[model samples]
Target: MLIFSKAKLVFLSMPKTGTTAYETALSPFASQYVCDPPELKHAPVYRYNRFFRPMLEKFVSPDIETLAVVREPIDWLGSWYRYRHRPFLAGKPTSTAGMSFDAFVQAYCKGSRPAFANVGSQVNFVKPQPNGTKVDHLFRYENQSGLLTFLEERLGIKIELARENVSPAMPLSLSPEVEEKLRRKCAEEFELWESIT
Candidate 1:
């Protein structure tokens, strides 16, 4: 997460949405940047509301707004699938070494997901908190220009992005049956993505 105190903006790092590149590009301008201990780095709305919100409100500003980027659902899952396919995770329970994209996504749609398909939901990551805290600005990952324009105008600085922490490229094909199951089981994921104009 990157916090620009002066701008009263906090960029929430939604996993697999290419926030790492934003973090890298904006770190120098941010008042605070949390990039370690994956849990904190990728703290969702609830986590931020619990941990960072109170502190920032007290010490920085009470009007801090949050920004988050969400990717197309299937593409997001594919990133996770390919990421775990990396050689480093070859033998781990979380590895997707021999799994087809269909199997991986089917696992993800399960009530109790297997380790390899346990990537957290993007919908949950940006869900509104009980106290009204929420993502004030949301962007689609595919719309880089829109996000960059918002950031540049808000921060009053020119911006550039470099790809970072990208998953390895692979040909992923999800069978129609599995895809249908995923959409049925995880409708919120699709709904949330579509809602991000």
Candidate 2:
């Protein structure tokens, strides 16, 4: 997460949505950047509301707005599948080395997901809190230009992003059956992505 106090903006890092690049590019201008400890680095809306919000409101500005980027649902899951399929995770429980993309996604739709398919939901990551704390600005991962424009205009600085923490390139496909199941089971994921115009 990157907090630009002067701009009253907090960029929430939504996983697998190419947020690492933004964090890298914006860190120099940010008053605070949290990159260590994956949990804190990727703290979702609820986590932020519970932990960071109060402190930030008291010390910084109470009107801080949040920004988040969300990728298309299938592409986001594919990224996770490819990432865990890396050789470095070969022996870990979270490894997806031998699994097909279909199997990985099927596992993700299960009531109790296996570690390899346990990538958290993007919708949940930015869901609105009961008190209405939520992402004030949301962008699609594919629309880099739109996001960059917003950031540059808001921060009053030129912006550039470099690819960071990218998953391996791999051909991934899901069977129609599995795709249907995923959509049915995780409708919110698709809905959230669609809602981000």
Candidate 3:
């Protein structure tokens, strides 16, 4: 997460949504850059509210607006699948080695997901808190120009992003039936991504 106190803006890092690029580009200008410890680096809305928000309310401003990016659900899952299938993760339980993209996604839709398919939901990460804390600005990962424009205007800095932590290149596709099951089981993921506009 990157916090620009002067701008009253906090950028929440959603996993696999090109946040690493943003962090790399914006960290130097941010008031606070939580880039260590994956738990804090990728802290979600609820986690921010519980830990960082109160501190900011007291020190920064009470009305700091939050920002986040969401990716199209299937592509997001595919990224995870490809990432885990990297050479380094060959022996790990989280690795997607030897698994087809369809099997990985099908496993993801299961009530109890296997370790390899346990990527968390983006919908839950950005869901509004009961106290009304939520992302003030949400951008689709597909809409990089829109997000960059907002950030540059808000921060008064020219922004440039570099690709980072990219998954391996591989042909990936899901069967129609499995895709249907994923949409049915994880409708909120699709709905939120579609709603970003």
Q: How many times do residue backbones clash in model 1?
A: 0
lDDT of each: 0.95, 0.93, 0.95
Where in model 2 is the C-alpha error above 4 Å? none
Error in Å for residue 4 of model 2: 0.4
My TM-score estimates for the predictions, one after another, are 0.99, 0.98, 0.98
Give the TM-score (vs. native) of candidate 3.
Answer: 0.98
Give a tens-digit lDDT track for model 1, residues 3-116: 999999999999899999999999999999999889999999999999999999999998989999999999999999999999999999999998899999988988999899
Per-residue C-alpha lDDT of model 3 across residues 70-147, encoded as one tens digit per residue: 999999999999999998899899999998999999999999998999999999999899999999999999999999
Q: Superposing all C-alpha atoms, what RMSD in Å does each candidate have to the true structure?
A: 0.6, 0.7, 0.7
Candidate 2 global Cα RMSD: 0.7
Candidate 2, residues 36-102, lDDT tens digits: the string is 7999999999999999999999999999999999999999999999999999899899999988999
Worst lDDT run of 10 residues, candidate 2, spans 114-123
For residue 102, give model 1's deviation from the true position in Å.
0.4
| Local distance difference test, candidate 3 | 0.95
